[model samples]
Target: MLIPGTHYRLAFTQSVLALLQVINAPTHYRLDYPDLSLILALVRGGSLARASALLKVDVSTVFRAVRRLEAALGQQLFEKSGAGYLPTTLAQTLAEQAERAEQALEAARIGAEQGGEVISGTVRLTCTDSVLQSLLLPALARFMPSYPALTIELCTSNDFANLSRRDADIALRLTRTPPEHLVGRRLADISYRVCASAAYVQSVDSHDLAALTWIAPDDFLPDHPTVAWRRQQLPGVTPSYRCNSMLSVTELVRAGLGVAALPDFLIGDGLQPLTEPLHGYDTALWLLTRPDCRALRSVVTLFDELGLALKLP
Candidate 1:
């Protein structure tokens, strides 16, 4: 019969040796994975210079990364062609796998970053000049102080910012239909009305819209609802002052330069509404974000706050 202490010692020694053997075993796949992004960029960009530009790295860095990947895989991933570096079948396969991996990694990273209890980090917001000036700015005054850790970057543009490319984290838009790719909440219906400076409204016959001096958006924004309404309502009328930005038009109108069709949200203290809230020109105001970005705590908080603010008189 074996002593209990001796038996225990024998078992412990065998367990440790077994663990060491498992630990020493060579992994089927290398833990030091190749730089997938560099490889993908090279394949996508087609040339060293192009890849360097795309990755924002030096050409030598791209060359070195490629060389390292080739050395690890023990194969030539690309061949020199007159057009560009032609990726081999193996390279193509690897690139495709790498893209999927990159997407997965990005999703994971976003999840980890946004999953925190505290609402923080920068939230990029995009909207039109009028909306930014009239509505969002005032709302942000109250909202910003509450979330001191959160920062907001506002981008004002007439054209829709690309959320997929990360042009903006959030978009406030007046549209009948928001982009299908984005996830959002429709806050409220925005109404357009003929507006003028208090002095202009008092001076002119408000009913004779065609007879009044008009301030219009520039040729670039011909599709603007106000432009369309003006085109329809005053067929032969030409604007006295044409401006590119709606904010500029508002300023001009407020200065009593010309009457303008303005959104209800933008008619501040100086401007007077000449017409009843028009029905056909109404569009819904939407707060939109990338599906992935909606998970972020800061984004969620801002979105909720904005919705609440808009509801207020």
Candidate 2:
């Protein structure tokens, strides 16, 4: 005996009332995407300072956001112990949900960016100078022009970029153990050899390791394998030239300043190996990206491309 469309009207009224109840609910807070993202950052970083760095905000801002979120929810989310901000169970759950939302949004953004025929968006890459000069730049030069809309920012440094902070989208690193948080594949084995200019190699008695003028990494890199090798293997030998950077050491050796240990990739045409691959100095080169960033087209493309291009023996 209901009127025509009466059921539809009732359903619409019920839907509106439910929405109103949610809006009026005492537990409701004006939570936005950024607020949810902040929670995830806090949980991941475990401290105001770390969260600040991750979000590119100040510590004070993170602190205030935590306070605001706590006040809005009427529950404690984090415990400020001496170590750092430890997330409570509620905070952890919320962060997990937020992470899912973040992933969805990121996927949508990436889709929009790649909606066109050409893959678009910027990818930031970080690596050492030797890797940059020898491998990355050349590979990029050949293929990057295909994606004219895509931008690549290369940051060359020996130091590790803070992947947690999103300082770089991708990192090519030479390390025995890559960070646990980063997900990547080992591209190749990095081997070091005692190298010098061809002329210098011919001039010096390569077998008489002690008599050759040595170039060593300076105290800036106290733990450089070359430093330890020189100290342990050639105890009485003092370096005639000490350079702070591996790139500098490579250049000096190339310029015929003295014999120095260099990565096999860095020893180009003019250089000759005085010794075979140093046994204990070997490390694997890794192509790494944050788990969250690996899904982006640009990062994925470059990472796969580099992995293929630099699959050295």
Candidate 3:
């Protein structure tokens, strides 16, 4: 039976791999040029519009190019999601090798321009700092224990990591959709819940919404769209304090600053989930990488670990 969302080349690869097994070739099958680049682009941009925009081509031109590529190879690269496209499983497998191949191609380009060459070397990776304390650090602890020979240069911050320019091997963020060129995953649907410490709840006696104190994220001001949205849902509520770090927000909430919208993963042990809504808000967490950097054994290992670490019970 044919699966609806599978990449088109998988059939060919399966046959090729089976044949290769009989002949016992010590290698893997890989895609050729432009098709590789095209697939990478679509995956990274997350939408046809973004891909076309970034490439400085008309959307129609990109559509035609993709059709041509698909015809030549007889592969359907992407499957439609509500308004975007996700790579098929075969696309994912191809992505693993394509990412490395793209890197080698980049090296060739570098060598051509500089009239020089260099050996392959390891790269550093950076991502959200909270993931370090909540998800990443623990995942690494488990991952590192097994891959003892692997050396990782890790940095964690909320800011973007530029993989195209090789700033990091991978990154994670709470965004709806990532750019097309990166081969990545939407690891989880991160949800936010307003929470407070037992001591703080005891202090607030007001049953009325108007009198309740609140804790807000630094970016959430009275006029901000997100804050405004929350306010519509939480009428008469106002923040008592604002903090940037999730850790700091948790600390303030514990110190009786007020109720804050915090991820379940970010809150401390034994805190009660606030039944009241925090101006109703939610955001997704994304795992990102340059398309050319997907599925390096190191990346695969780490990605899987991080996914497991971030999964909600």
Candidate 4:
């Protein structure tokens, strides 16, 4: 026969034992374990089917992962409606924490790998195709030997590269004024000048500028600075061809198609430069970076090298 006080104590001890059992659950019972990486991948992918496609996993696998997560937390983390599942408050909190952890892990990896004094990491440089063909490639050939540690990623697109989003670290541009947020060097006062092949000159009678057909690029519209200048300077000049690429235009002119505007550098490679001016046209070429980013060791070194090598006073 136990006393009433002893019986109370025994009951209390059992209650505490039950609470401890719940608190110290096995690793398999914890939802916030290593499998949360999959949960985060789903959060980014937005839809189950999309997440499955992105992860290259079956839809059922993703469903099971989420189900296991919900069970571990003992909560309904998503509300499935006619329009697909929406995350509950608990899921949102988990997603935020997961994102932070993912970013931290990435930063840790970068820091670990690049712990030395060497300046390294990938740097993307954007420029026009023509510029790349004429200038960047040769420059890079020379540039590579010195800084073997640094890698150059050359991306050529006619459309502007957004420096704010890190689309490119440095850009070679033909704009007179760079965007307000960007710092740039005036690489050169790039001017477009009209020229024709020696054969075209012989056939068309180079003296008659208005009579000869003008060769132009498709995107160089009449309203463009170059076209506008030509129209104002050489009125009633009809174009013989409008090709998309500068290389194409060069080829057409090479075959005596008609007179075309050639960049100075492109003319250096045996195409022949025209001494006479056809139309008054001029524009500046720029190399720019986000002002905040110029301090980066890689950006600064590239900027200085390109400006000094290319931009002639």
Candidate 5:
């Protein structure tokens, strides 16, 4: 009874509406969650070798994990470039989510441990070579025995470690200005003194800093306050030896190569101080940690112990 043309148009309209509805409906895709730890390592380490080292896995394993993640998501998470595997936007988002989840898990673990009698966990601590050798190791030798179950992973480097990235649970830094995001206590001012090998001190006019052959930290430490102070005090005094590391500079001075500015803590039996302890050129030492990490029992215990040890004579 219906007109053929009108009926055809109505059916077509209805079909198009149904198609639109289907298109508008959210598509559900099942994805197998990739290993969150592997992803976090990749994100933080930024290279295959680095990720493998951080995760303590073989490089091929990381590659396979990345491939699996890509396949599961049906999208590339990272792109291979000349520098290394650069994470895509999606990868960054995924990494952020993983970090949040990790934080939540850590919080839960810490809470559960707090309810228990034993305080046990690993705490990663980072500091400069000088601090590690002169101060921290000795302190830990005594402090660690008190907590039988606690484990300490010590990392020594001259470069500033980013605590926010979980590079370390605790960091000891000598800085005039600490980063705003980090929460910590400024322990004390690290004093420095002009020092030379006993032989070198005997040979030169000990009173006249200018008459002595100098050993200075190289351009690697351009912003070092004591180095800058030395430059100002001895104008046009070219160093006989320039070393990249402060420890190397100290060693060179100890070898009677030249006189150099050294931290008070590093003035060993072989070296003699040319000047009394100098203060203004020194930087304040900070015991720093990320805000989220402050709650961890391991971090708190180490932080308190380090603060007390550093304050000691």
Candidate 6:
């Protein structure tokens, strides 16, 4: 029997073909699958850089595609704007049709499972710098050697990558709830604690939290867990150091600059916890990937390996 969405996917495929035929007849200019796919990605992403990331191509390639498609169809598909590339009416319509076609094609590909050794191609994984250094890298070191020909790209950032837009194939995030659109499971409970360098902890009177120097998340990170926790728990106290990145804050703590709230997994080396996990500052570590990407062998392998390795014993 066919997969559950086979009929719906086939219907969309037929509709896209009908739309393409009509578009081609009047202009007598043939646009191939690549051209349409680029258009759809460009429209969805709204910029050359974003489109490039989604398509796994260079920015110049996306720019060149735009120029070529405009020349071929003799229509202005997009207009340059301060924000990014703004799609014109024609581009928007074409993109909608292309998107449906792309979805149908991907569904068919996933259905086939394309039985073969998945020995090549890069899989992009996104996560925070802290996660990269503390957890993911070690797990990857063990898992990557197994797939000799496969390459994995790491995109480290504080912001979540847009998997729906294909910014990355998979993501390892610390969150209470993963996005509904992505498929994944919580690996473990991530706990946080007030931490300081072991030397600093020993030098200072640990019981006197108010007397200790403090480091905190900067103004840019107003929503950071440490920000509110500091304000509420240590009222009227000011931080000596403020960093926008959690990794940077961790480094500052390691240097014995000041005490700061940090994830338990990240508190190692010479760091020591001043308190047990801070209440209301805990979240789970989640391994998430788009539903479409979950079908790919490379993604499946990495996902499974990470799930098995990262889960707390």
What is the TM-score of each predicted model, taking all chains together? 0.61, 0.61, 0.53, 0.59, 0.62, 0.62
Stretches of candidate 2 above 4 Å error?
Answer: 1-116
Each model's lDDT comes to 0.77, 0.78, 0.63, 0.66, 0.75, 0.80
> Which digits, one per residue and each the tens of the lDDT, describe model 1 over residues 80-198?
89999889876776676665545444444455566743455668899988888888988888767766556678888776655767899888888888889898888888888989988
Off by over 4 Å in 5: 1-116
TM-score, prediction 3:
0.53
Give the runs in model 1 whose Cα sits over 4 Å from its true position: 1-117
Give the runs in model 4 whose Cα sits over 4 Å from its true position: 1-116, 220-224, 274-280
Q: Which is the winner by lDDT between candidate 4 and candidate 5?
A: 5
Best by lDDT: 6
Lowest lDDT 10-mer window, candidate 2?
14-23
lDDT of 3 by residue, 1-313 (tens): 7585233344234433432332222343334454556666777787889878766778888788877755655567678889697887766655555555555544544555667652332456677556667877776776565543345678765556466668788787765556676777777766666677788778886344346677676762233223555567776666777766566777777777677667656877756776543334556677777766664666666666677766656
Error of 6 at 266 (Å): 1.0
Candidate 2: tens digits of C-alpha lDDT, residues 150-179: 677888766565576788999998888888
Q: Tell me the spans in candidate 3 whose CA falls farther than 4 Å from its real position.
A: 1-123, 220-229, 235-238, 276-280
- The number of residue pairs in model 1 that clash at the backbone is 0
Of the pair 2 and 5, which is ahead by TM-score? 5
Q: Mind giving the per-residue lDDT tens digits that candidate 6 earns over 1-313?
A: 8797665545465655665654543466766666777888889899999999999999998999899878878778899999899998888888878765665455445445755444455678999888899899888887777665566788886655557679898898888877788899899998788999988887889877878898888886787767778788889789999987788999999998889999878888898888978888788888899989867887888888889888874
Better structure of 3 and 4 per lDDT: 4
Superposition TM-score, candidate 2 onto the true structure: 0.61
lDDT of 4 at 241: 89
Q: Candidate 1 versus the native: TM-score?
A: 0.61
